[model samples]
Target: MGADTVYVGYVGAGAITFGAPNVLWNHSERIEAILRTRLAVPVIVDPNEARFKEIMEQKGNGDYADSYKETKWFSSPQEAAMGLDNETKDKIDFWILAAPPHFRGTTIEGRDLELEMIKLFGNKANYFVEKPIATTRSDEPHKVAPQLAENKAVVGIGYMMRYLKVVQKVMSIIKENNLRVMMVTGRYACAYKECHKTPWWMKSQQGGPIIEQATHFCDLMRYIGGDVDMDSVQATTLEHTEPAGEIGVINVDEQAIPPEDRIPRATAAFWKFDSGALGSLTHIVGLHGIRYSNEISVYADGYQFRINDVYTTPVLHVRTPADDSKEQVFSYPEDDMFHNEFYAFLSSAIKKAGKPPLPTEDLLSTEFLSDFADASKTFELTWRIRDISDAHADKLLAQKAASSKKASA
Candidate 1:
């Protein structure tokens, strides 16, 4: 690594499995594109040796065949954080912590790998961390927030939706008009039968669908509407039961896991924003096949903006009284939010280094939307919604149990 070159250390390859189109859309490609640098042999760190080997073997078959070939590998986050030579560590410009949420934690030696890397690299290397920060009920992120802030680590979370062109346009309109958002509504529906067969199906693993999947829309709501009043939040969920044709029923074997550990078929939640705006979100996992429908609409005085199909083809529909109430349609079929987010992050990192000046407006405009501390608020909100939903389910169960006992008596 040299002054002119940028090196990146990837913590996990799970993004390949999680992202659409597999390896092609993984973070590595985007990071490489932003840095304008290619790794002759990329370094990948993962604890699962067999899985890594499988990915390596399948390298030559996918979209970016040559991009998949790599050499440097580490068995654990600790190994990657400490095993790399001092010179290499100092030279690495960025780190992509794409490990699963459960695995993003301190090592057995009680060293926080992320903080350790920040310390080892002298806090120069920026970090791009994945979302849901943690799946379990943990205060680690809250505890780590101060340390990261003290270190001035520029960490970005994986809420790429905030970087979408349509989203940016909506924000611009709101800002230009000085519109006070009155309400925000988000709906996310996914084909549960076709996808989400992995650990995502377990509540204990991924914190249910709201924390794992619909958190994106939740983040967007917060991004557009402002911080949520946590105390004002209320949520309800549709749980799976013995009924055969229930919405919660999925193709997977339900008997493998206890019903309590499974995720809900649908969840609906609403709350008041700190700005006194109302916000609501609904997530349903009952759809079949591989199709997904997602939309978020913002309402203000005499204006409405609805962004639809965010994952595939994003289109924003606008209705305003200024134009005699005529609807205006804007489509962004070629927009790549993932690329836009990474580019913004890498550009921010580069600017911090006093490198060549890049356009400041769009590059860092939405940076706060995905910063670690800011993202933690969204993460905590998702967990709060989960907790509320869980409490409601438990109350119902207790009532059912009491009724059963009385009937037996």
Candidate 2:
């Protein structure tokens, strides 16, 4: 690839979503950032005809849409791959695999695109893939990890929360003070009634909320407190039938979904980190309206860091022994974490391709954070929590059944 231009191949468009009125979500923000880059020319590749038509119809609706008006479009991954191979193999610098989780393992034509990219371009196969690598317990990513290691593919997993300025400040403080993290706690609460009535409601499809939504916090917990001791993980959840008011009911029609396929209304999980630090995460869907409350706190020996309002104006509160334990607050009202994540990946791609470095300093030193193997670990953690919580729910059901049998006898 030349230093003057970067040609990118983007896999999916369904990840783009709207939050508030005329306000794009984080995924959309990422696409906007990529499109706005001076030297990047991206092409959209998707197999869904309906989605393609929908995006075309809505192309003039927002700034993000307007930026991609003249972009190329492909109907399938194979078509895009062939076109790149034939025309711009040397110029193809990076790929954005933003497809749905289920499609990540194998596309519509049963192709492992990530592995194919490695085989086709080797080390030049840089990618920015989305989270929860796979929806189901697929071994494709596990199989591809060794090849990624061999080819040294520059891959960046989409855990954008780590790029927040507040988060960076926390990391700097920890590094400067040589703080040994003692505990990390994260809470994610949102309104269930306001959730979109999509396939996300089906646990079998979306892998439940913990895997789909709360995975962000899980990754952050691992980032702050070292790797987790997977065997020490434990969890419990509030089932839909537990009680009326305990778990908020979805306003969407769910009669088609069977009882077993329904997701938990609330889940609480805790784990022991390899660093001897304890971590806990709670996700509750009982709030009202579209407002969401998300926060995380890290506790060290003599220092405490608490981050609040992650979705809106992020604020970091610090308490240290040197300050007489008085709270010091710092606010970042206009931080674009999604943009930061995109720019980091692009800069790394350019550097790895031997092109002249961009003016912006590289924010991440490593090839990538949350690579395929690391993302697989986070994926395993979420499934482990779901499995344990399901077991707890099963025990409760069995005990209730035994009591009913004894009373009838």
Candidate 3:
């Protein structure tokens, strides 16, 4: 495999799951599959390649390895990076960090590799990080930015939906119409906390729905509604059944929590963005993913784009252009969204330039929006203003200042 194209090296378990945690998950696999067809050689798979091999050994479940049977494997991602050093004669186009589990936040385990990859191969290759870039918004990681810049990190938070063709069209419409997003409505349902197969509902440490799953919707909120100004946020937690005592992994401490009383439900609020766009997001693991599909609708300029089961193709929706009620259609072109997303990250890496030529305003906006979920007994908002030249920064700042005054008034 030469460096003509980016190679994917998926690590961890969730990626190993059957269908998808999200539609783009499957879409990414399909795009990679398509690329494999058009390319001279088959694409590669690193750590995930071995994990599936192990699973097929004992459980006889082919689900994990089936799609990626011919795929390559590396000992660890770093080892894979090293292998590629020789594998491609050091002409790697870019590397994909599709690791899961860190969805909640970075772990103490193998923490060294994260930074080491930045320091050692920092410039050796460019890479892409899946969305929710880190376990949480830990500024501590940016301390390593110089090394990251040296490494030529053309990294992206894989917020595939923002780049969806229709979504982009919506953005174009907004800019074309000079529309301002006023509100967004979203809903999701899953089985009760007791029925969680992956135990994601147990606690945020385990990555309960909102941060782990609903993050895409959060990003879309910003994407469709423009920026947000989170004024205040509140949440209510539920603990009807504490840890129905299931024996577990290193992260699961069944002993500390009694089998009968594990708290699993929480409704949250986020009222804080300089943009002052109010947002409402909710999630419940008590319902089945099959029983409920994702919903997103934006209200702005007396126009709305209603999308149902938005994750997959045929994004269901009713659109309005000022006067007309709305036009509903099916099988709209969303695959292009995934296609653009793929090229955006790869091109950024190849060109060695600014944020993916497509800087997902959606992802950047949600980066702070979800922190509204974690309440600290105090109404809170957090921010870290980046250093930038004054040329146009002041104008954006002045607009926010005027907007804030109007919002307060």
* Best model number under TM-score: 2
- Candidate 2 C-alpha lDDT tens digits along 1-409: 2345556666776644312345544454554555344444446678777766666566557554544555566776667666654555566677877776666643223546666656555556488887767766635566666767777776778887888778888888899998899999999997777777756777887888888889888998898898899899999988776784254457766667887777888889999999889999999878888788999999999888999988777899999988955798877777777766766777777677676665653333323556777877777788888889889988987898899999999
Tell me the tens digit of each residue's lDDT in model 3 across 1-409. 3334444444443442223444324434444543542222113443565555653352234323333444445556566555554654244445555555253224244643345555445555555555444554444334434445455454445666776656656666667888777777666554442443435434335344555566676677665654555324434333333243222332334446543333334334444434555666655545532455567776676677677766655364546663575575544552555556655555455455232232243312212111211211111121211111121334554687799899999
To one decimal, what is the Cα RMSD in angstroms of model 3 from the true structure? 12.1
TM-score of 2: 0.87
Q: Model 2 Cα RMSD, Å?
A: 3.6
Clashing pairs in 2: none
Whole-model lDDT values for every prediction: 0.75, 0.73, 0.47
lDDT of 2 at 66: 44
Worst 10 residues of 1 by lDDT: 102-111
After superposition, candidate 3 runs with Cα above 4 Å error: 1-29, 33-73, 77-89, 102-109, 112-114, 136-152, 191-198, 226-231, 237-272, 286-289, 313-321, 324-340, 347-409
Clashes of 1: 0
Candidate 1 Cα misplacement greater than 4 A, ranges? 1-3, 15-24, 37-43, 48-71, 77-85, 105-111, 196-198, 242-245, 357-368, 403-409
Score residue 111 of candidate 2 by CA lDDT: 47
Model 2: residues >4 Å from true position, as ranges? 15-23, 26-37, 48-71, 85-87, 106-111, 138-140, 244-249, 361-367
Ordered from best to worst TM-score, the candidate numbers read 2, 1, 3
